[model samples]
Target: MSSTLAEQRAEWRERIAGIGDTLRAESETNEDLRQLSPATEAALRSVNAFNLCSPEELGGVNAHPRLQTQVIADITSHDSSAGWCALIGAHESAWLASRLPDSSVERIFAHSDERWPVTCGSIAPEGEAEQVEGGWMVTGRWGWASGIHHSDFILSMSRITGQEPEPGKPPPLLCAAAPKADVVVEDTWHTLGMRGTGSTHYRYENVFVPDEMCLAGFERPPLRGGGWLARPTVTFLTAAGYGFPLGVAKRAVEEITRQATEHTRTGQRASISEQQHFQGDLGRCVALVEAMEGYGHHLFEELLAAPINSLEDAVRMDDRARAALRWAHQTAEDVVRTAHEHAGGPAVYSDNVLARLLRDIQTVSQHVIQTQSAYIRRGQHQLGIPVRPGL
Candidate 1:
């Protein structure tokens, strides 16, 4: 009578596979536009690909992490821009689903089959909220707010200037949502890669959000749906953030393999795939990608299983996932670079898949969650050095 979860996932996978051909065809256009085309966005919505881990009550499929990761990575194999958007859109949906209030979540999923009412958020408080009767008037500029162009609603974190909540704690930071009309999006996302994400700077000038739309920073206790979002923020973010890099590396290897099979150097007597050097490099790159991806997923399983009730447990969880992500991110870069080198001169062209992967991998690698500097923090904590707060 009803499709099994496995069947639905299989269908979704097939849809993803189908979209790859189209996305590959439009990769350059997406790059040129600095955002996914409206048609492409609609295509993504048709599959409900954006809300992979949303609560079932909220009308999302609540896709298992394994399938979700695979879908994101697989899409990346055909087109980095499309894959990048998919990763970000789904990642944002899941992350927001975990953090938003129940009332907000209900409204977000008011329509079961549609992709609208999604919200994007930021790291630190960027807005300054002045107290008002119903809620507060927030004003500030937040940069690199990804998913803005596609979002119907946006939540900006803001500091409440007039409150001294607790003795040791600084002024409370309030994360609240407002309609898209409240924002003045500045075109600031011109970039070498992931340009299709529409990560622009949005400004809020005294935008008022009701108290219900506001999520209290510290006192909040997973107020929204809890069962499906059992894992802590660290578990979701570190894992999702690294997905793009993993996809990039995978795509690079695939492109290199295809190239090696089809072409050879000017003076070479054999196709690149027939050459020993290309064989060694391809094998090495594939192994590197697999090892990092495997180990990352393993740690992800441990991360989900780890208790996050206490501060100590939370730190451990963050550290474990962070360590895995750091290694994977660095390894992905190395693997992509190797593949690029193996592709040689052909990798330099704008239309070349290897060239795009090279750019996309490097861009996603620079993300704060996957940055190499995380290693320093991890090493400091391990060696008994007093690392900064929130390490």
Candidate 2:
């Protein structure tokens, strides 16, 4: 299975290369439109480009966590907005694995195919649910629904029925899934960067979501899905989410490097590359970005190797995972900012590739998962203190 997974990953990488051949020319237009262009979307869909991190049972290519990360970065190197959507969508797949019952999997697969097989998920638990016969009636408004435009299903976090907690207390939360047809999408993704991701607000009211669609625990009965699905979903989601910032940072460095010899001071004859100071900064920035990737993979590899026999063990692993991602995100921000400065005036031009990269990285830095709050949470975790929810 691993071998097959590897072969499929190689094929996907090749496909990414093919798709990238066209993105540079269209990325600006797509970002301006606030959604993927029809031609770009159709071209990507033709090559099964959006099926990263899918379960094999659902016709997924079974890219492992590391491979999935690489895939998002590769795509982001061409188009940050598309990469952002893929990052969210791919991690959402990991978030859903082993959570859905076989019936739900069958249901999703019944209408899905290689061309389109995954749903987009909201990161926060911001909805309400009412107890009903054999299930709950879920209703709530959620924001940051990235990839909604292309998905067939949507996953949301909601307070289960009759389980509302007191003020300043936590409520009973369940991750629920519903078909996209039952979701109401709003255009709310306007931002400084990643304009094409279409991560807008959405509403679902009184939708009957069966227990099968609710992920009550980390495989309480252990959904028959194996491999990474059997691992903790939250930790995996945290780890995978870093891929977005990493990709944007990498693209910034690449764009700057290409223009290094072309940029010069107003009165200077030597290009930026010819200036020792700029060269030194570029070298350090590249090293930092590359080192962060190595660091993330090391921590993630260690996480996958760790065993989980108790909730405490799972929390410890998650803390480590979140910390590792934090390092990557914070470092990615620095790398991109350095590259932005090194690239000069062109970097700030609205239509320049460096400008887009800067915005995308900045946007990713503000994500709930990648924020500095994670540092505090990790510190608390290390001191054996209970951190906030979602850790």
Candidate 3:
């Protein structure tokens, strides 16, 4: 009998779990070299771990952010870097599909050559898109384009001529689709962790994006396209993007608990789990994760209920979603730190999994969404205070 989608997902989950041991080892070596191993990349592709975020109709698992984050958490428990890359890559196409015209969905998925997700982002307005007869001529370089090494397409962000966004005005965040032929990967992903993700810089010179390929909120009834984007953009993709850290944090908590149960200090005969102080720490970590999980669930439910194109209706929910992300990352940081501390001196050892988990968690927590300024803005908005500009 053929396997159901749920069964297939379970099978893939098991495969990812099995590779965790190898990924853990490779990630350590990659950290030393500041690059991911080709073997690791192949391992991710073999099990189809990058399709977790695709739409159900598109041969993807089509999991919600809550379930998707849980899956990523499971994978990262054994190897944070692998989970990070896998989740981010899988979601790229899903996000793009949501913004595209309904008629284009079949073609995007029908393209047999389009394997892997299209990971691209640059909000600095570095790329310029000039309006043309049928489409726009996009030309510029975008930094930090992840998952492109193996991705079949690129979703480049660019700035176009438009009026200054007014209060309550939801301006379009321009995204231009390009095949591999139109883009060049610069191999410039040198970082503290997630180095193996191959998040390289990309260069686009005079790439002509057809009107049918360009995605913008103003271009409704998208030129014979098809995908999830029949509605608004910010309310959907922004919520999805926040799930990555939640996965990383969940793994950090689980690893800490497992280590606490198995390992013992040199002078102590009993494991760290037997100590009362350690018990409190582990218990608190559990509570922290539970809290984040609750916050995330509530925000997702709110997002699901929000009407498409109802920005006014979504403003409060959007603020809540941002707050949830901030809380999740903060909780993750605390849990990971506590876990690292419980691991004692071994946590700092290059070969130890705890060391890498610490680095990965820290790297994600530093993202702007989880920063103090983002949280303050959300909180003030929620409280009806006048939030300053440039937040």
Query: Against the true structure, whose TM-score is highest?
Result: 1
TM-score-based ranking, best first?
A: 1, 2, 3
lDDT of 3 by residue, 1-391 (tens): 1266466546656776877777766876656645456666777776666766666556665665555555666666556666666766666666555556666556776752346444444444568787889888888897766556666677777767654566875544567778777887786887776665666678889989887776554334333223322323333444445556666667777777778777898888889889999989888888877777677666665566656464444455445566677777777778878888888767888666667766777776666555677677687886788653332
Count of steric clashes across candidates, in order: 0, 0, 10
Is candidate 2 or 3 superior in TM-score? 2
Candidate 1, 10: how far from true, in Å? Answer: 4.0
User: What TM-score does each of the candidates earn?
Assistant: 0.91, 0.90, 0.80
Off by over 4 Å in 3: 1-25, 29-39, 46-48, 101-107, 112-117, 161-173, 218-235, 238-243, 261-271, 307-309, 386-391
Can you list the residue pairs that collide in candidate 3?
Answer: 98-229, 101-225, 101-226, 102-225, 102-226, 103-225, 103-226, 104-225, 104-226, 105-226
Kindly provide the TM-score of model 2 when superposed on the true structure, using C-alpha atoms. Answer: 0.90
Candidate 2 Cα RMSD (Å): 2.8
Off by over 4 Å in 2: 1-10, 47-49, 164-170, 216-222, 384-389
lDDT by residue for model 1 over 30-120, one digit each (tens)? 7888877776777677767677666666665556555566677777777776666676667566556656667766776677564545566
Candidate 2, residues 1-391, lDDT tens digits: the string is 3366568568767878888867667797788788777666765566655655666766665556777677777777888877777767665664565467777677666755644655786747788888788988988999888778877689888877677578995766878888898999987878988788788899988899888888646435345445555566667675556676678778878888888878896777899889898889889988887887787677767776788888777766666677777778778778877878878778778988877777877787777665676677788887889754554
Winner on TM-score between 1 and 3 is 1
